[model samples]
Target: MTDNTNNTPDGIQKFSMNYSERELECTVEKEGNILHLHIDNNINADLEIQQDGSLIQTSGPELPPSNIDFIRKHVLGQDAKGSVVATSGE
Candidate 1:
């Protein structure tokens, strides 16, 4: 949930991890069925875990936006259920 009283157009829903300076601020306009990772504005990557607890990660420059869209659609949507997604690694 977010404090929408200010009426910001960007409307970023934020989540933070322990020991990380940059919090993962996700959008809430789409279905986020996947997790995304990015670094230094040049590298992009994605991750998805199946129902069987399997993990998948995709790497490229174009992955961030797609993953961000997923965060908007699925992660922030109240109709969806899950723990939380994150970005990790160096």
Candidate 2:
């Protein structure tokens, strides 16, 4: 008898973040001049390439707390991504 084994779930890499009581999971993929952000298998955000090399989000009703330098320092380059979360009014 022969045995075969594989440990790849859905054959995809999972990227996610957790903050406060909110959680977000996404798979990053590059497509032409856009970065696709998917959440739970749905298109949630779109990042566009700017003339100055900066990126901007073109969706959602509000912006999320983020640290671009956090990505730059670790990513080892001038790349950025957007995050979203609910906030309370004071």
Candidate 3:
């Protein structure tokens, strides 16, 4: 597993995962109580995160099973802050 995290100057936090050579990236931007999740690479989808932590896909193509599972297990519920946080899963 390969993971990378970074923060943009505009306050968006980006987290990427490379597993089995497949890469997926998510850019998280929070405004007030809503969080916008933009997925790229392996999956292309714009998701709106509700205050209750529910994810609603707003746009982009359908995601594969692997991508969906990855988002739920690792990306969802993760807090986005103005700092870098990275990890690798075995």
Candidate 4:
């Protein structure tokens, strides 16, 4: 969980990820039960908690299994006990 002291508006969380070449500042928009990830201006994804306690990406760019799990654990802040749904290729 993030504190309001981070300068983000209430309900919004921000984090940073170290990629191969650069560090990316990530933003998460919480809307109801959905968590919207803004990896950048264009690259984004929406994850929703399913009835079975699974986290499924219902929209946005096709990310890898590792990346999705990374979001689920690091961004969503849980080692999801239920299924962590993957994209088509995964």
The pairs that clash in candidate 3 are none
Q: Candidate 2 — which residues are off by over 4 angstroms? A: 1-13, 65-90
Q: Give the TM-score of candidate 3.
A: 0.42
Stretches of candidate 1 exceeding 4 Å from the true structure? 1-31, 61-90
* Candidate 1 lDDT, 1-90, residue by residue in tens: 432211223232345322134445432321133445444443445555434322344433333334434443344343333333344433
Model 4 earns a TM-score of 0.66
What lDDT tens digits, residue by residue, belong to model 4 across residues 1-90? 322122223277778765435677778786656778888565778877555445678888766656666665664456344467865421
RMSD of each: 10.4, 12.9, 11.2, 6.7
Clash count, predicted structure 2: 0
- Worst lDDT 10-window in candidate 2: 1-10
What are the per-residue Cα lDDT tens digits for candidate 2 across 1-90? 211111111222345654234566656455554545555564355544444434456554323435222221222233333232233311
Off by over 4 Å in 3: 1-10, 18-21, 32-44, 64-90
At residue 56, give the lDDT of candidate 2. Answer: 56
| Model 4 superposed RMSD (Cα) | 6.7
Q: Between candidates 1 and 3, which one is better according to lDDT?
A: 3
TM-score to native of every candidate shown: 0.30, 0.47, 0.42, 0.66
Q: Write the per-residue lDDT of candidate 3 for residues 18-67, one digit (tens) a residue.
A: 54476657776654433355656344455444434444455556444455
Tell me the lDDT of model 2 at 89.
Answer: 19
C-alpha lDDT of all candidate models, in order: 0.38, 0.39, 0.45, 0.63
